[model samples]
Target: MDPIQGKAAGTAPVPLSVLDLVTVGEGRTATQAIRTGVEIAKLAERRGFHRYWVAEHHSMPGVASSSPAVLLAHLAAHTDRIRLGSGGVMLPNHAPLVIAEQFGTLEAMAPGRVDLGLGRAPGTDGATAAALRRSDRLHEGADEFPQQLAELIRFLDDSFPDGHRYARIHAVPGPVQGPAGRPPVWLLGSSGFSARLAGTLGLPFAFAHHFSAQNTIPALDLYRESFRPSAVLDAPYALIGVAALAADDEKEAHRQILSGALSMVRLRTGRPGLVPTPEEAAAHEFTAVERDFVDGWLSNIIAGTADEVRSGLDDLQKRTGADELMITANAHGGEARLRSYELIADAYGLPG
Candidate 1:
């Protein structure tokens, strides 16, 4: 892949990527969700998407990607070129050394086609997070994310300091040489804290605009302003993940987005479950409060015809100066979701 170049006035098409939550839709099983995810990854690679990433979410009936490393390995086996990674893996749920080994093993398998995008969030509710961490205290590891990130990097690079306690503990299948060296590490954030940390550490940054659109520009600005040259990156590089749903027509796109909108409503109300079908979303009645919440949530989503969505994304890139755009789409069914990506890819003219 070529280094990302700035687009003047955002007229030039930027690299596009996919961030899959592996959502298990209404009446669908986790098995079916995984199958759809793998199929989408294969299609995404063939359609010229730069990367196909899976997100981590624990104990969520709607989301099947509880273990990004495991899903990434499966994706790596099915796809050839598109980079496979965690859109991100929530680092607070596991130990740094464990994540290093998991990703190190993935790098050994896929060689140059692996990335490690790390997040500080627990990726689950308090109960589930505690279960995953095997600790009673929730968020105990979150505060140590920066230290853990640095340690994980050292493990991947096999560059632990000589006198460090973990210096002698080498991660098997450690850093490779040439183009397939240790997988690139990216810090994922929805706030300025992580943005500044990524900058200070000189790592690539990916902001979650899909869920936190209001903070996208601020986080990106902080990342760029605080960046310092390091061995991994000489200049600041950032990607913004957005929620997008494209269809042949604007009405169809809006209808498809209703399912996700309904799902968000349920999630925010502490009743999260499988993503409902369009029919269910259509029949469901919403109170004024729920309507307002859903409306505000939907405001961040780009839903329209191919051309319309493409225009919105272009404007977003211009405003954020994002090096790449990672899109996540959820629809009533697998085919509609796939079509959304197809339409966006066609509009962007991505080469296979």
Candidate 2:
């Protein structure tokens, strides 16, 4: 594939990527949603997307990506070229060795096309996080994440010091099969804590700008200011994940993006449900407060016709100074989401 070059003026020529939540929309089953995710992986590869990442959201009725390793393994099988990864796995909810083994197995299978993005957040409600960890002591685990991260890296590198209790243990299929050895590691955050940590460790950082737009620039600043050179990086590399959607017509794009904003309202109110259709959003009566909240949420998203979305994304890249932009299109229907990517890819003239 050729280098990414946006067709619009003032657009930065940065790589574009995908972050799939594998949303289970209204009237669809988890199996159907997962199949759609597979199609997205293949489409992304064919469209020359820089990478394809599935998020690890559990116990949410609207999201189906509970097991990123399993989903990514399936995605790797269907797509040969695009990078596949988690966006990401919650480190506080699993043993370090387990994560290393899972992603290492991915590396062994996909060779150099794997990335391991790790995050401190649970990615779900406290109850689900407790269930996943088999412990109610969640705060302690979250606090110990830095140590856990170190342990995971040691396992991935097979570099534990001699006499350490786990020195003899190994994450099978690790010390990865590819010549690149271990997959590239990225620290994901929606806050300054992880931004500073990622910078301190000299690893690439990805900020969740889609939801936490307020913290995006501040966290990126902290990352760059705190950074120190290390083997993984000589300079700070930052990627911002943005919520974007595009359609053939302006009104259609507006409707689809509003559906996604409504879904967010549901999630925030502790009433998570399948992604509502555009028709549903249009017909349903929104209270003044809900309408205001939805409007505020919608402001962070870049949604419009293909040309508008392309220009918006370009301006975002330039303003944020992000090395790349990973778009997460959360429109209600799979077809809408698919078409959004298609239109955006064509608008950018991505080498497919």
Candidate 3:
């Protein structure tokens, strides 16, 4: 029997994957959090998880995955099998050429194991967005996403039309020009805009269901409705990123998830800071409004014992019809976060 993933493990309901935030806990340093992310990726690969992705968020003390490309390079060195991707990279904050070259380098390192998931949002607030992107393009960021996306694809494939200014430019260390050579591009979205665009382009789409639960179905519907068969895909392929945490003890799982809830509360209230400990979250004072907000957020997260978490994930899959379920478990400590995946993997009977 395999030590990490048992050979007798039961079949899973659907493909299960992971999205690592590289979260910095209240008492942990960023360096430690990053190392923990490496461990998580290695574990995911050993346990037969489909993919391990890192998110990109800046100006937030809790999230340490600020530079996904840099971090993905590190993860690529540590894990051999599991697919490594940005859960995703916010395109507006970067130039098309820069992303193409960066991801192109990643593809060279990991070959077909690399995936480039792109998002249109700046991935941070207005001030940080201004600092990351050009001042002239600030106002037109969202409006310019389609054009920027087109340019990015062109750079990745060296398909820029003749006479174009960038036609002569090429993404160096470029992977082969075929489907398996380059990193597969997946459009990430929390709304219908990217859904429609991704479907129209016949690319895979991943929704931020962990944050935008209400829009999940609508956006997915829009994606399927607008889908047009292209070389990349002949049918709609959708993945949902969900917030879930499974543990040996239900109480412990709830406590860990509460820490994440507190962090989200701080982010929503414009006081973003490191993720608090369970004790700190337990001691937090909440007004009626804040209490309501916490309750609503908690409702979306599937946190409990392994069996309970399995049931919740199964139910969510039935409702969403997601081709893949990418879970993002946010706990105060790295061990707790890693353990959550282990418990969930056992519950789902994932095999190596």
Candidate 4:
């Protein structure tokens, strides 16, 4: 039997959820990028993973998931059992009602298998954030993300007003007398502020551990410490983002990681270029600062063979005790990237 089955393991086990980075790896079109994501989701479902979430990012040439809701809807249609959701929708980018309508529609279609993870950060550059919402409120950080979260819940609650409705502001295709209700609502964050907010509001928390490795432990501690029982969640649900890339050997795994490092380099430098092939990354000469950045970030990543990946996951689980592990593989080479997720699943004794 798996060492860590139903119970939380002292050293975390296999059988974790996979997060698709949707990096456009040597692919001719965006369709290829999303298709790879769907394929990965299908593989994850076959492996009995918990969820398959796609993230939202705008104007990142390497990432194709600018519209997480739409992509999630597509992924849901393709897979039968794996949970589908937004790793997060940057709440400040759009109106809450529109988000409600989109996710409510998704819940109507997928029912119990959808997830709505919301985030307050603007997922793009300052100029792009301005383009997304040109109003002074958005530009000046006037987004009431917490209040909007409540409104979204109200829209999803079929019995929000104790069945005797009040105003004409109900979400169509919402929690009506139907098959069931929407999926669980989770708040995503990399800081203590969002963690505390999620705790106070009684919502599940998913930390951006991949991007904010520095804050992972502290944020989770804050969330769990301040949690209060709510109708939706009696206890805190914590998911941590994990950067992983598994290959046939240690050397190859390190070589494969160049893709992710290159993408990160592009992002931190304000270039936001396309996801490079492993060969391309190998060809480029990284500056000392860029090399340092990649090495520093790589410390948080798990790159090795299947067994090595499993061991790394075990260490992470032991250290943080996350409720779920969300895997992200955006390394170089599209085919290799896809294969990396496969290796992770196999290491965990999952189907691929």
Report lDDT (CA) for all predictions.
0.85, 0.87, 0.88, 0.79
Please report the TM-score between candidate 4 and the true structure: 0.92
Candidate 2 per-residue C-alpha lDDT over 29-77 given as tens digits, one digit per residue, 9 for 90 to 100: 9999999999988998888888889888988999899999999999888
Clashes of 1: 0
Model 3 over residues 1-352: C-alpha lDDT tens digits?
1111112235666678899999999989999999999999998988878888998999999989999999999999998878889989998888988999999999889977888999988888888898887584676888898999999999889887889998788887663444547788899999999999999999899999999999999999999999999888878889999999998888999988999998988899999999999999999998888899999999999999999999998999899888888999999999998898888888877764
- How do these models rank on lDDT, best leading? 3, 2, 1, 4
* Model 1, span 55-136: residue lDDT tens: 9988778889998999998988998878888879998887888988899889888988888999998887888888888997
Q: Per-residue lDDT for 93-189 in model 4, tens only?
A: 8777788889888988887778888888888888888888875456445348877777777776744564434345766677555656676788999
RMSD of each: 2.4, 2.8, 3.6, 3.5
1 versus 4: better lDDT goes to: 1
TM values, all candidates? 0.95, 0.95, 0.95, 0.92
Q: Give, for candidate 2, the lowest lDDT window spanning 10 residues.
A: 1-10
Worst 10 residues of 3 by lDDT: 1-10
Clashes of 4: 1
Q: If candidate 4 were superposed on the true structure by all CA atoms, what would the RMSD be?
A: 3.5
Off by over 4 Å in 2: 1-12, 176-180
Candidate number with the higher lDDT (1 or 2):
2
Q: What is the C-alpha local distance difference test score of candidate 4?
A: 0.79
Against the true structure, candidate 2 has what lDDT? 0.87
lDDT, residue 5, candidate 3 = 17
- In candidate 4, position 195 carries an lDDT of 94
